[model samples]
Target chain A: MLKIEGLTAEIDGKQILKGLDLEVPAGEVHAIMGPNGAGKSTLSYVLSGREGYEITGGSVTFHGKDLLAMEPEERAASGLFLAFQYPVELPGVGNATFLRTALNAIRRQRGEPELDAMQFLKLARSRMKELSMPEDMLKRGVNVGFSGGEKKRNEVLQMALLNPSLAILDETDSGLDIDALKIVSEGVNALRGPGFSALVITHYQRLLNYIVPDRVHVLVNGRIAKSGGKELALELEAHGYAEVAA
Target chain B: MNAMTSNAEAFLRRAEALATPAWVGALRRQGVEALARSGLPNRRVEAYRYTDLTPVARAEFGAAPKALARPELPAQRGRARMVFVDGVLRADLSTLPPRPLSDAAPLLGTVENSATAPVAALNAALAEDGMFLDIPAGENAGLIELVSIVTEGAGPIAFHPRHVVRLGEGASVTILETCEGPDGVGYLHNPVFEVVVAEGATCAHTRIQREGQGAYFLSSIHARIAAGGTYDNFTLNAGAKLARNEIHSALEGPKAACHMNGAQLVGQGQLADTTTFLHHAAPDCASRQTYKSVLTGNGRGVFQGKILVAQVAQRTDGYQMNQALLLSEDAEMDAKPQLEIYADDVKCSHGATIGALDENQLFYLRSRGIPEKAARAMLVQAFLTEAVDGVADETCRAALDEAVMGWWQGVAA
Candidate 1:
C-alpha cells in the first residue's frame, strides 16, 4: 500500500535519491539493499517527512493518500512508522511515558479515545514481556544508557504497541547482534498480516534470513537499479553490491 | 539624575514610615546608605555587568501592601508551612509544630545575627511576620514549607522572608519554598532567605518562582554548612517581568558538601537571572553547580556563577556548569562561569555554553511522527531535566517538573 514514483531528493544541495520508483502492496514485506551513499536511508527519511531535505521532484502515496503532503505526526497518525537506525536517547522522558504520549497523540488524531495511565501501563508491561525487555527499562529514560540491542528491541516494542499499517525499518539490523537481529526480525514477522505492509532497508542480507521479504529492490546511486525475488537478497550476500551495480 | 537617586529616596521614605524594631530600622538605613554610596550597580561592577538592574532602579517603587490571605496548599501534603504575603509574614495564616523547640531555641533567637545585606536588611526592616524552624541535634525527618504570595497592587512591591534553618548534628530536613501571586494588579516581590546546616546534618532546600507576568521578582538565598554537613538547593523560575535568584553558600568545615541546581524558562520580554557564588572555605569540601536556561521570543536569561577556594581549603573539589538554549532569533542568553582557586591542591572547574536546539536531535524526534512543536518542546524539557532530577526530594522534584512543563506550555502557546 505504498508507492514512490520518480522520488528525486537532495540534502544540502547534493542529490541523493534521483528518480527512484518503487511500490509495496498490502500484506507484503519489501527489502531495499544498497551500499554506502546509495540513498537507502534517504528514502526512509524522505518518506518519514523529515525537514531539511529538498524533494527536488517526485511523489509518494500511502494507502491511497498523498504521503508527501502529510506532516510527520500526520503520517504517524495515518499508520506510518519509522524505526530509526540510531535510536535517540531522551534523558528525562521515560520510555513508557514517551510511548503513551505518542500513542495518545496518534489515537487522538484518529479520533480514538486516549488510554489512561493505568490502562497504558498494563498494555505496555505485557508488550515489554513479549519483547524480553526488563520492566525497569520502562521506568528509565528512553534509550538512555541502553545497550545497542536494547535500543533496537525498544523500537520493536514500540512497533508492537503502535501497530502501524506501514512500517519502515531503516537499518534496524545495524549494530544489533545475531540474537537481537533475530528478535527484532521475529517481532516484525509476528506483525505481518493482510492489513500490514513493511519496507525494510539494510546493507546485508543476514536480516532477510529471519524476516524474509516478498520482493527485493537494490538501490544504487540514488535509484532502484535492480528488482528481484527473495532469492535476490541471498545472491547479493554472496556476490556483494559491486556486481549488481556494475 | 540617575534612577537610583529617586528610587533610593523613595525606599528610605517608605522605610521611615514603617514602625520597625530600632535595630531593624537601622539596618534599613544602612541599606539606603549603601545604595547612596554605590548607586544601583552598573556594568562596571563585575556581578552586575551582564544583568543591568537600571531599568528596575528607574521605576518608582512603594511599600508592599499588608499581608493577604494565605494560599491553600493543594491536597498534596508536605512537612511544614510558612506563609508570606506581599513581603511580610502572616503568622495568622501560617501553621507550625505546637511544642516549643528544645534542641534549638525559637527562630527569634538567631534573628539578630542575620546579616544586613541591602536586600536582607530591607526585608528585615519591613517584614511583618515569618517562620523560623530548628531541627534539634540528631532529630529525624524534619520538613518545612515556605509559601510566598503577592495579593495586592502597591506600585513595585518587595517582600523579604527570612528563614533560619539550624539543623543540629546529624539531623535531616527538606524545605520547599513556593512563590505565587494572586491575579491582582501587577507588583514586585523581593525575598531573602538564609539556611544553616550544623555538623553531620543534611538540608534539602527547593525554591519555586511562579509569580504573575506583570510582577518583578528577586530572591536571594544564603546558606552556611559545617563539617560533614550537606546542602542541596534547587530553584525553578517561571514567571515575572524581571526575576533574579541569587544563591551564595559557604562550606565552613572539612568534608562539607553543597549541590546547587536550577532551571529557568523565560518568554516574551521576560527577564530571568540566576546568579550563584560558592565558597570553599575549609579543606576537603565538595561543591557542584548546574543550571540550565531556556529563552523564547524576546526573552532574556542571565547566568553568573563563580566558585572560590581559599588557600587553606586544600583538597577542595568544585565543579560548575551553565547552559542555555535560545529558542528564537530574538531570544538572548548571557552565561558567565568563573573559578578562583588559591590552593594548588584544590580541584575547581567551570563551563558555560549557549546554543540553539540540536538539529540532529530535532530531526530524530520529528521523524518518529511527533509534531515539530511537541518534538522541540520535548528536547528543551529534556535539556533541563537533569538539573530538576537532581533534587533529592521526590515531591519537590514533581512540583518543579510540573512548573517547568507549565512554563513550556505557556511560552510555546
Candidate 2:
C-alpha cells in the first residue's frame, strides 16, 4: 500500500534521509528501529508533508498516487495518517470538535454521508470504551493538560475514528507505562486486517513485545541497514545499537 | 482657533438649533463647552497615549448632518427592543421594558459628569435622545436590546446617545446593545451608558460595535454597584476605521462583583481600543477583566486596564488579562495593564500576551485533514471565545459568536 524509492530529504540545508527506500505491503505491520538522530521522526514528517523540509530527490507513492506533491491535508484525505511524536496542545479546540471536523472532511472527500452529532457521539463513545478512555476526555481541549498516557490514548482514539489505510505511529510508546503500552497495542491490534497497514517507529524492543511486527528494519544513520523478523528486535536489544550499527 | 476646534464649535452650534427640551438644550451647550476645553484628545494625554484621536478631530464633518434613510436592523426574540436612528429614539419601533421605574422621571444627565471623562461629558451634552430602563425589585427582565443604526449619509457627522439602566434591590436584567452603519459614511457615534445595580441586583451588558469602514465610534460606560450586587459586561469592537470603548465600574458597597470582558477583531487600516478601570471602594469585593484581539493587515489594537483597591476595601480580589493575536507582520497590539492596591489584604494581578498563531498547532490541524484556511478561522474563533463566554446569557453569547463568524467571513473576503 506504501512505497518509497531513493527518498532523499533535508531540513535546514542539512540532509536527513539520503536515498532511503522502504515498502509496506497491504495487511502487514512494519517496525522501523533507529538510534538518536537516525531521522526516524523526520521520515514520518516528510511522509506527512510537514513544512520546513526540502525533498531533494526520489519519490513516494501511497495507493499509487504521488504523495510528495500533495499538501498535508490532501495527503490525509488520501488515507495517510501520522501520529505525531509530540501532539500539540490546542488550548481552546475541543477534542470532540476536532475529531468530528477531521472525520467529516475525510468522509466528504470519500463521498460518504456525514454523521450528525448524536451518531458521532455514539461512535466515539464506543471507541473510547474499547481504549478504556472515559468519555469526559472528549469535552476538554485537545490534550490541553492531559497526562502522558492520556495523550497516547487520545492519538489511538483519533486513529480509531479515522480508520486510515496506512497509520504511522511515531514513537507512540515512548512515555507510556507498561499498562498503557499494552492498551495501546490492543487498540492497534483490534484494527489489524487485510485492508489496514501500519509503520510502527520505535527505538526499544519493549514496545515490539506488545505489538509484534511482521518485519523489523534496523536503521543506521539515514538508511536501513538490515531487515528481519521479530527476532531482530530481540537481538538488537541484547546488543546495543553500536554492535549492530557497525 | 484651529480648524478642528472651529469645526467642533460650528457643529455644536448646529446642534443647538435642533428641537430639544430645555434641559437637553442646556446639556448640548455644556457638551460644546467641554469639547472646546479639550479640543479633541491627543497622544499627549496619558489615557490616549497609544491611540491618537487627531484624525477624528481633523475630519471635515458637515455642520448640519441629517439622516438620509432609515437603518436596517435584525429582529431578535425574547428581548424588548429600542431602535435609535441617527441618535434619535424611534418610539414607533421601541418596546419599553416592563415595570420601568424611571419611565415617569427624567433619566438624562442622571450620571454626574467629571473632568476626567471629558468625552462622556461631551456625549451627555449632545445626545439627541436617550433610553431609561428600570427593573423593579426582585424582578428578572429576560433580555433588552438597544439597536443604534446609522444609514448612509452625505458627509461626516456625529451623534451621541445616552442610556440609563437601573435595577432595584434583588432585580436582574440583561441588555444587548448593537451599533452598525453603512460603509464609507464617516459618522462618529459617541454613546454614554450609565448603570446602577442596587443591593442584591444583577446586570449583564453586551455591546457590539460594527460601524462602517469610515465611521468612528467612541463609547463610555459608567457602572456603579451596591452591596451584594453583580455587574457583568462584554464588548466586541469588530468594525469601524477607528473605535474606542472605555468602561469604568466602581464597587460602591461591600461584597459587590464586577466582570469586564471583551474581544476585538480589526482588519486592514482599522484601529480598535478598549480602556477599562475597576474601582474597588468597598471591602470584600471581586473584579475580573479579560480581553482578546485579532489583528490582520495594518490593523492595530490597544488595551489599557487599571484596577484600584481603596484602603477600606479589605480582602479584595482583582484579576486582569489581555491577549492579542497578530495574523500579519504589519498588525500591531499595544497593551498596558496596571494594578493599584491600597489594602495589604487585597489579591490583585494583571497579565498581557501578544503572539502569532502557533505554527505547530497549525501543522497539527492541517495534518488532520483540515484545510489551512479552516484551521486559521477555527483558531481565531477559539481565541475570541475564551473571553466571549463570559457573557452570562446563552442567547446573547450565541449572537456574539455569530458576529465573530461574520467577521471571519469578511476577513476571508
Candidate 3:
C-alpha cells in the first residue's frame, strides 16, 4: 500500500534522511526502530507532506499516487493519518467541533455523506467509550490542558474515527502509562485488517509487544540497516540498536 | 484643518437656526464652537492618528431625510426597544417611547468630556432626538434595545443621536444597542451615550456596529460608576467604511467595578477603531479591558486603551489585554495600551499581541482534513472567543455571536 525508495531528505541545509527505502504492503503493519538521531520522526513528517523538508532524492508513493505532490489536507483525504508525537493545543476550538469538521471535510473530499452534529456526537461518544476517554473530553477545547495519556488516547480516538488506510504512529507510547499503552495498542490492533496498513515509528520496542508488527526494520543514519520479523524487536530490546544496526 | 473648519461652520449654522430648549441650544452652540476650534480631527491628532476623518469632512451631508422607508429590523432580543432611523425616533416602530433629554439634563453631559471626545461635542451640538431612560431606585429594568438604522438618501446624510441611561441606586438594566444600514452607502451615523450607574446599581451595555459598507460610524460612550456599582460594556464592530467606538469609564466611588470588552472584525475597504479611557478614582476599585481585532483583505484596525489610577484609589486592580489577528499580508493593526498610576500600591497590567494566525495551529487543523479557509475561520473564531464570551447577558452574547457569524459569512463570500 505504501512505498519509499532512496528517500533522501534534509532540513535547513542539513541532510537527515540520507537514503531510506521501506515498504508496508496492504493489510500489514511495519515497525521502524532506531536510536535518538535515526530520523524516525523526520521520515513520518516527510511522508505526511509537512513543510520545511526538502526531498533531495528518491520518491514516495501511496496506492500508486505520488504522495509528495499532494497537500497535507489532500493527503489526509486520500487516507493518510499522522498521529503527532506532540499534539497541538487549540484553546477555543472545541474538541468535538474539530473532529466533526475533520470528518466532514474528508467525507466531502471522498464524495460521501456528511454527519450532522447529533450524528457526530453519537459516533464520537461510542469511539470515546471504546478508548476509555471521558464524554466531557468532547466539550473541552482541542487538547487544551489534556494529560499526556489523554492526548495519546485522543489521537487514537481520531485515528479510529477517521479510519485511514495508512496511519503513521510517531512515538504514541512516549508518555503513556501501561494501561493507556494497552488501550492504545488495542485501538490500533482492532483496526488491523487486509485493507489497513500502518508505519509504527518508535525508539523503544515496548509498543511492538502489543501491536506486533509484520516486519521490523532498524533505521540508522536515515536508512534502513536491518529488517526482520516481530522477533527482531525482542532481539534489539535484549541487545541494543548499536549492535543491531552494525 | 481648513476643510474641517468649513465643515463645522456649516453644521454650526444649521444648529444656530434650530428652535429648542435654552439648555439644549446652549449645548449645541458649545458643540459647534468646539468642532470649529478642533476642526475635524486629522492624522495630527494623537487620538485620530490611526483613524482619519477626512472622508467625513469631505462629504457634504444634508440633514437627515424627513420622509424615508423603515428598513427591516433585526429579530427582537430585548424586552423593550427604541428604533431610530437617521437619528430620528420612529415612534411607529418603537415599542417603548423615551422621555426627552430635557428631564435628564444634569446627567446628560456630566460623564463624558467634550474636550478630548470631539464627537461627543459634535453630538451635543447637533443631536436632534434620542432615547432618555430613567430607571427608578431599586427597580429592575430587565433588557432594553436601542436600534439605530441609517438609510441612504439623495445625498450623504449626517445625524448625531444622543442617548442617556441613568440607573437609580440599587437598580439594574441591560442595554443592547445595534446600528445597521444597507451596504455601500456613504452616510454618517455619529452617536453619543452617557451612562450613570448609581450606588449599588448595575448596568450592562452592548453595542453592535454593522453599518453599511461606506458609512462612517463614530460613537462615544461615557460611563460613571458609583460606590458598590458595576458597569459592563461590550462592542462588536463588523461593518462600516470608517468606524470609531470610543468609551470613557470612571469608577467614581469605593468598591466600584467596570469591565470593558470588544471585538472588531474589519474587512477589505474597512477601518475599525476602539479607544477606551478607564479611570479608577476611588479606593478598592477594579477594572478590566480586553479587545480583539481581526483584519482581513487589507483592512485596518486600531485599539487605543488607557487606564488611570488616582492616588486615593488604593488597592485598585486593573488589567488590560488587546490582541489582533492579521489574515492577509496587506492587513494592518495598531494597538496601544497605556497605564497611568498614581497609587503606588495598586496593581495594574496591560498586554498587547498582534500577528498573523499561528502557522502551527493552521497546519494542525489542515492536517486533519479541514480545508484551509474553514481552518482559518475556526482559528479566528477561537482568537475572538475570549472577548465575545465576556458578555454577561445571554441574549446580548447570542446576538453578538450571530453578528460575528454573519461577518464571517460575508468575508467568506
The local distance difference test score of each candidate is 0.80, 0.85, 0.89
What fraction of the true interface contacts does model 1 reproduce? 0.54
Give the per-residue lDDT of model 2 (tens digit) for B333-397. 99999888899898898889999998899899988899899899888877987898778788789
Instruction: Supply candidate 3's per-residue lDDT for A102.
Output: 96
Greater-DockQ candidate between 1 and 3: 3
Q: If scored against the real structure, what TM-score would every candidate get?
A: 0.91, 0.95, 0.96
Clashes in each model (backbone N, CA, C under 3 Å)?
Answer: 3, 0, 0
Name the top DockQ candidate.
3
Q: Give the TM-score comparing model 1 with the true structure, all chains together.
A: 0.91
The collision pairs in model 3 are none
User: C-alpha displacement of B168 in model 1, angstroms?
Assistant: 3.3
Q: Locate the minimum summed-lDDT window of 10 residues in model 3 chain B.
A: B108-117
List model 1 lDDT by residue over A1-246, tens digit each: 898999999999999999999999999999999999999888998998888799989899998999999888889889999998988888877788788878887888888999999999999999888788899998999899999999999999988888899999999999999988888888899999999899999998989999899999999999999999999998898888989767
RMSD for each of the candidates:
3.4, 2.5, 2.0
Docking class of 1: medium
Model 1 C-alpha RMSD vs. true structure (Å) is: 3.4
